[model samples]
Target: MRKQHIKSHPVASLYVENQSWLRGWLYRKVGCTHLAADLVQDTFERLLKRESYGDVEKSGAYLKTTARNLVIDHWRRKALEAAYMEALHIQGEAYHPSPEEQHMHLDLLNRIDQVVQRLPVQTRQVFLRVQLEGWGYAKVAESLGISVSTVKRHLKAALLECCFYCE
Candidate 1:
């Protein structure tokens, strides 16, 4: 039965049905076959890690949305890597880290990115404006139209998230 097939090999069937078009879509967006292929795999891998991924509707829209997020994540990681390398270059060869340290730093950056990405939208906005942009709590609260106490709450939650992930 068709139901039996899906129950037995849900992801494999989904992949067989959607992989080619999804790869094509990614290639059109990123302009690279290799990167597109890589992102396609990443998207499905992300689905497999979900506890109830099998409950996802057998729909193109869901798959497309997942692939789009992977593309956004890929772009973000690339930008982070470029900025990091630029910072290191500015420090000159005399300040260059050992290769192992450099790898560790980049990996840490990626993990931090993941933690930030997991934050809720308002919490992320508060955390970013305060921490990343150096805005005071009142300033960030005014800009976001949230109360200062709310801003502090969000920052506390964000800090707790970071601490939880650090270990």
Candidate 2:
């Protein structure tokens, strides 16, 4: 059974009170007013889709966190697209996947990114260094100041999470 939701802070009230501040807040981090405004709209749309803001005691803080996350997501997506384009460039047009395959690959990448983002902070860090940066376990452990065993543990956890989503 779903827990009943009550809108202690109605989304309109929250939007009216927060949009300008949130936009500025996002702009500071993103350095683009248009992008900030777009993120602000997306942020509120997020709240709108929720059953409720529920019992949020500090709505501004919550909004800031949410907005910050959106900015991070925006950057991550940009980086991912750049990398995909770079890979395609390396492969050349003749080797390119069909549009359908390209879309499927992007969707999978997004889903895997979401999984990585959901990982515990330390685990995510370890996973990125090893997988994205091509760092070995020893190198990641040394750089992170953790034991090789600990690095292996984090990688194992990350791989298990990814594999769970795989066929």
Local accuracy by lDDT, each model? 0.89, 0.85
Worst 10 residues of 1 by lDDT: 51-60
Q: Write the per-residue lDDT of candidate 2 for residues 45-162, one digit (tens) a residue.
A: 8777777567543468877878888998999988887888789999997789988998788777877898999999999999999999999989899898999999999999999998
Question: Can you give the TM-score per candidate against the true fold?
Answer: 0.78, 0.68
Top lDDT model: 1
Model 2 misplaced regions, further than 4 Å: 1-9, 24-34, 49-58, 133-153, 165-167
Residue ranges of candidate 1 with Cα displaced over 4 Å = 1-8, 52-57, 141-151
> What is the overall TM-score of model 1 with all chains considered together?
0.78
Clashes by residue pair, model 2: none
Q: What TM-score should be assigned to candidate 2? A: 0.68
Error of 2 at 51 (Å): 5.2
